[model samples]
Target: MKYLVMVQGSQADYEAMRGNGSAQSPAWTEDEVKAMYAYMSAINDDLAETGELVDGQGLGEPAGTRHVTLGEDGKAVVTDGPYGETKELLAGYWVLDCASLERVTEIAERVIRCPQPAGAPVYPVVIRQIMEGAGDDVC
Candidate 1:
């Protein structure tokens, strides 16, 4: 089965990495940033060798996000981010193809160990199985 593993965390975390803001943020050293990438690459290498990793990528911070929704008049409405009322957003995701739910869960567990901000708490990873395509109908 194909499962999508989503990494959920604060968008501020990314900003801090880029040295953008966060008065309370610790100094992100150059070595630490390189090490973070190295750690992530190692994880991806392991998964790729096992043929479990299908694809994955990280998303930009929510500040650059444009949230769109349909209005009552069926018009598309657009709004900028730094959205309110949510601390956790989908930071990134990994698509894993594995045999069982247990196997997929294991992949999600591994993802939780990836790099994070200094003194950051353990974040959450959401896993969901992708449903097969609708049967041969083009309606």
Candidate 2:
């Protein structure tokens, strides 16, 4: 089955991250950035070898993104960054085809075990099954 794994974060958490910035930024130490990326790259390599990984990518900070929705008149309504005040915002996602939910859970667990920047907590990874398409007649 195919699944979409969503990674979310909270506003307070993001604010703290923003303060940490990239290694190029004045806020983060070079060692800290290097360790973070090293861990991330290792995880990517593991996923590639597993064959369960379909596609995955990390996103830029949410402050640079926007949210758009349709209003009652069907016109587009745009909103500023991060979309909502919810405790979690999507940080990144991965789509994978796995043999069973057990397999998917294992993958998620591995992600949590991967190293992260010092002081950064493990973010939740939500797994959701994709809906299969019906024939044209169903529509």
Candidate 3:
């Protein structure tokens, strides 16, 4: 089965990572950021070697995000930036082909352990099984 393992954050979190600390998140030192990248890279390498990694990537900040919705005229209405009221946004994700939910959960545990600055916000790592079918109604 394939699983989507995600980590979420807010704009404040992104700012903190860039050394602009706010009450919502602490500033991350240059070394601390490098450590996080190294750690995540090691995990991805291991998964790739084991054939469990289907795909993975860290997303850009929310500032450049675009929101689109259908208008009354059936045309697309576009808005710039993250969701109007959403405080948290997806920061990164990994698509893994694992043996079971338990296995994916184990991987998520490692993800949650990624290095961060002291007092940095801790958000829950989400794991969801990917649904695959052709109108099979596997909701």
Candidate 4:
């Protein structure tokens, strides 16, 4: 079965991210960015070797999300950027094809231990099974 592992962070935890401070601080140093990429690459390699990795990538910060809601009139109201509390922001994700939920959980446990930028605490990953479906409708 296919599973999506979503990485999320709390507001306080995200605020503690060291490299680039949220619009208030400078960008990450070369060494810091390099270290983070190295860690991610290593993890990707491990996943590939284990035949669990379907596809994955690191995502930019959550400043580009858009939110859409319905007004009282039932018209669509669109808002720019992250509309939810920063504490519930999604960081990144990985899609994996695992043999079972137990295996997926095991993989997530390892992913949770992957390295992060200095001062950036390890983010938590939530694993969810993807149900088979037709077109856009899930079964």
Candidate 5:
């Protein structure tokens, strides 16, 4: 089975990415970013060697985000910027081909511990199993 491990970052992280000041938490410093990159690199290397890593990449800041929705009259309504109260945003993701949910959960554990700021809290990772194709075998 394939599992997607999504890294959901907090508002503090969002502020750091956009060069804005975080109201409550401190932004991720340069050293923290380097440490995080190094940790992620090591993990990626390991997963690639094991043939478990399909693909992954960190996302850019939410400053460039856009939202499009249909209005009551069915017209498209477009809005820009990182709108309301998004405490957590999808920061990155890793797609892994694993044998079991338990194994994927284990991978998530290691990913959660990826080096960040000294006093920063651990962010949540949303793991989802990729279902088989529609035309595939039923049995």
Candidate 6:
């Protein structure tokens, strides 16, 4: 089965990582960021070696996002991102072909332990199994 594991962030979190501290969080040092990147890379490397990693990527800041919807006239209506400074946004994800939900859950648990500054807030990692087809199951 394939599972999608995700981690969320807010603009505040982004700013803090870039050395702009928010009232609720401290600025991350350069070393701290490097540590985080190295830790996550190690996990991905391990998954790839185990033949479980299908795809993975880290997203850019939410400020650059654009939203699109179909207008009443059947035209595309577009708007900039609505994520406020503190609003949560999808920050990164990994698509893993795993043997079972329990295995994916273990991976998600590892994601939650990614390195961060001591005062940084802990975010939850979400996991959802990818359906193979329409007849597979309804989520």
> Scored by CA lDDT, what does every candidate get?
0.77, 0.70, 0.92, 0.70, 0.79, 0.90
The weakest ten consecutive residues by lDDT in model 6 span 79-88
Point to the candidate with the largest lDDT: 3
lDDT tens per residue, model 1, 1-139: 8888888656667766776546544445667668777887887888899998899888878788788999999999998987867777887888888899999887777767776566654677899888768446556
Estimate, for each residue in 63-133, the C-alpha lDDT of model 4 and write its tens digit: 66677899999999988764454546677788998899998898788777765544555556898887766
Model 6 segments more than 4 A misplaced: 135-139
**By TM-score, how accurate is candidate 4?**
0.74
Report RMSD (Å) for each prediction in the order shown.
Answer: 2.6, 4.5, 2.3, 3.8, 3.5, 2.8
Q: What are the runs in model 3 whose C-alpha is more than 4 Å off?
A: 135-139
Q: Give the lDDT of residue 121 in candidate 6.
A: 82
What TM-score does prediction 3 earn? 0.92
Clashing pairs in 3: none
lDDT of 6 at 81: 73
lDDT, candidate 3, 18-56, per-residue tens: 999999898899999999999999999999999999999
RMSD of 4: 3.8
Scanning candidate 5 in windows of ten residues, the lowest lDDT window is: 17-26
Worst 10 residues of 3 by lDDT: 130-139
Q: Among these predicted structures, which one has the highest TM-score? A: 3
Error of 2 at 137 (Å): 9.7
Q: What is the lDDT of candidate 1?
A: 0.77
Off by over 4 Å in 1: 20-27, 134-139
Summed backbone clashes in each candidate are 0, 2, 0, 0, 0, 0
lDDT of 5 by residue, 6-117 (tens): 9977546767634444655567766777888899999899889989999999887666667899999999999876756776678899999998899889889999888765
TM-scores, all models, native as reference: 0.83, 0.74, 0.92, 0.74, 0.85, 0.89
Q: What is the lDDT of candidate 3?
A: 0.92
